[model samples]
Target: MKKIILFPILLIISFYSIQNHATAVTKSREAYEKTGNVIWEIKTKEKLVAITFDDGPHPVFTPQILEILAKYNAKATFFVAGNKAERFPEVLRRVVKEGHEVGNHTYSHLITSKITAVKLKEELNRTDNIIQMITGTKPTLYRPVAGIYNDVIINTAIKNGKFVILWSWDQDPRDWRNPPANQITRYVTKGINPGDIIVLHDWHGSEFSQACQTVMALDDILSYLSSKGYKPVTVSEMLYRSKTNYPEPFYPFR
Candidate 1:
């Protein structure tokens, strides 16, 4: 009789363990899709474009952007520089801690559009590895340096199970060149509509601190977008909502 009871208990335990593992698998898949490029191929069917900040994790500018994001309770995606990731690991952590997603922008910020295939993979691998080290998960999303890429780069990202994310050219403002903040705000707010993705900077240069009119314009832009009945969402949340996902182990599902 004792043996019979023990056997049943053991069976129950095994069942629970299997159930838990299945749940884990589901969650992992969800993460994969959220970072996958399915959304890249599909435009924001609604008035929601992803806000992605690239080439960052800089000391001063990164923090400023994070602070504003915190203030507005806004979430955006940060496509980090790999070498900078190693240099300023804390900034990367702060980004995660503050409820934002981190994606790979490559180690050297070399434009994948220009590099050879071998070099592209090497750069992506190194950057993805370092980002995983800091964030505890490898990103399946790849935003080429300076939003630059070709068919080869896009194909490479797809082949590696990564989605190549691009931007909608609504607001650039040339902040990298120290464009005026008011003008930047005017353009971004005026141009923004439903399902629009506004690109901005986080950490970059001394001029970037002055150049990034985005941070300053956040209040006006957010307010305007809100008035227009659009909600600001991070890249991951946008993808997740749209049912975009990657495969397990952060690679192509098929």
Candidate 2:
């Protein structure tokens, strides 16, 4: 009687936790919608999506992730910090050389919510210079560190000629926290839809093992996307292929 009672209780608790998580994600998407000039996800029915990796140019794990992406012929975007790119120029170059999109992730990965507009501009310029120095083309996309930004930050980025990018709310698996590989894979693969943007980290400066776990999840994610007849493209490509679906529904949960 105790075992049977506990099992049902555990199931109820698990379901409640998942519901809360989904609600939080929905709230975040609503907040993002209020912040104009950000592209969280495109709206389309063409079976295309974008994969983005942040804080990267890791010499070890980045190459591993790249290998996995190449295996599936999938294209992604890398939002690289200037300090890391400076340290791992070869890895950064390899990311661009292989046809992946590169974006500015700021100079030192400073959290945008706590920084001033001037400081943010300085960070963005420093990162753009580093990326241009290595890749020969300035990045047209910018994703602030920690996905924290306001209208001021967004306008600042626009003045610098960048379109601010954010990932799909449902697609985040918190890989930086070093969750299990299967959990990361399931979260992403399950939430996937046409025009969705999936964010994963390729380098965690202090959490070395976290990126390795992301690399482990990448193979499975790509395999599942391929099997489902989905095409993984760069964020730019997704935007280009997007339909003119205007004023998405208030909830927009899929």
Candidate 3:
């Protein structure tokens, strides 16, 4: 009996190990166009990292970040809050127009738990309708407010037809509090490896232009990482690179 139990236990462990190691393959290539950011967030094994921006397509500063990203020809994921989208519809358009991936950040920026299933779908649908109207493409990625996700929120999002996206790591500089550039860079450049999905803000709009640290500091971070042979692809790229069905390599960070 012991032998029987031991064999079964080991078999279960082995199956889990393999499932944990399985590569992520999207059966729907059509899913790729809309779900690229979320797909990459969950899949991929490459040395790619998705540098994601949340909170805005801010009225003023988002354009600055866009200019910088454009200069590098880099791709990123932006989770735009729905109300912000409604206010700055042009910015939302500019995000997609500029080749950045956009995902739902919620309609009112409410936490996932506070919302009922009905309200949750409404938030997602509202954002979906708005984005589809503007870009003619419906988004498949949704990040709950502040990443405060639960089973209900996840299920609701999926039912509303979105992939639940949360970060695997955290590198936030609390740039919202306006930490120094070097401090911010340190948080990012340190503890960083391949397959990291870094969350940065284009604008918290908190009088926190402290991201100015990155203005001078980005080159340093990029140059050093480049020397280390790191390729900073979008978060979607990292998900695709992991090919790991599990979120082992995630670093959902600021």
Candidate 4:
């Protein structure tokens, strides 16, 4: 009787341990799924870089940035928040009219990791609707607020028919901190290479001064990139032009 009880107890303990270990492994994989499953850059030998701006369609600064881009005969991608797009429909329209690409940056600029799946879908769908209403074309590219994401965010975006977009060469320049325009330009242009996706901001909430600084830096940044023989293209264009086989819209996970 002692041996019989011991054998069953040992089997039960082994089963419990195996279950716990599997649970731990699943959790670990989910956590790892957050950061690595994003597209940072495209592989290409072509002298092209994609300059992207987020939190924009600002009533003031967006036009200035567009003017600078036009002056350089360069194209870029603007990841506009739905709220901002609704507020500044003309600005958003100008972004499309001027031959630049538009991307969805969520409806309310909510952080993806902090929201529920339903809320995430709402955010993306709302933004897509607004963009489609304004531009007659929904955005296929999606950039998460603050560049933070997770498995849920990625899956939600893909489900909503968006390709998750992140930058490859962020050298942020802390422009949102109201740094000098030259500093912002240096941070972006320094060590910038082909296939790099640069992130700049055209809006800074109520900080009009910081927005002005971004505009100020644009001319210099454009000039530097032009002198280097680097043509600024939209993210879609970069991906299409890339020589390497990049996964469409999402990064592959093993």
lDDT score, candidate 2, position 51: 93
The alpha-carbon lDDT assigned to residue 162 of candidate 1 equals 76
TM-score of model 2 vs. true structure: 0.80
Give the best candidate by lDDT. Answer: 2
The predictions' CA RMSDs to the true structure, in order, are 15.8, 14.9, 12.9, 8.0
After superposition, candidate 2 runs with Cα above 4 Å error: 1-36, 205-211, 243-254
Candidate 3, 1-254: lDDT as tens digits: 99988998999999988865554332342353253333323444455666777777677667777776776666678888777777778877887777777888877778535566778899889988877787666777787777665545666777776766666555555555556767877888787756666666655644344445444555566655666666666554455456644332222221
**Model 4: per-residue Cα lDDT over 1-254, one tens digit each:** 99998999999999977754442111343343354335677678999999999998888889889988999999999999999899889998888888889999998987535565678899888999999999988788899898876666777787776777878646567676768988999889887988898888889766364347888998999999999999999887888777444334221111
The number of residue pairs in model 4 that clash at the backbone is 0
lDDT, residue 141, candidate 1: 75
Off by over 4 Å in 4: 1-37, 207-211, 243-254
Q: For candidate 2, write residues 85-189 as lDDT tens digits.
A: 999999988998888889899998876364656788899999989888998878878897888776557768878877789998899999988789999999999
lDDT value for candidate 4?
Answer: 0.80
lDDT of candidates 1 onward, in order: 0.69, 0.82, 0.65, 0.80
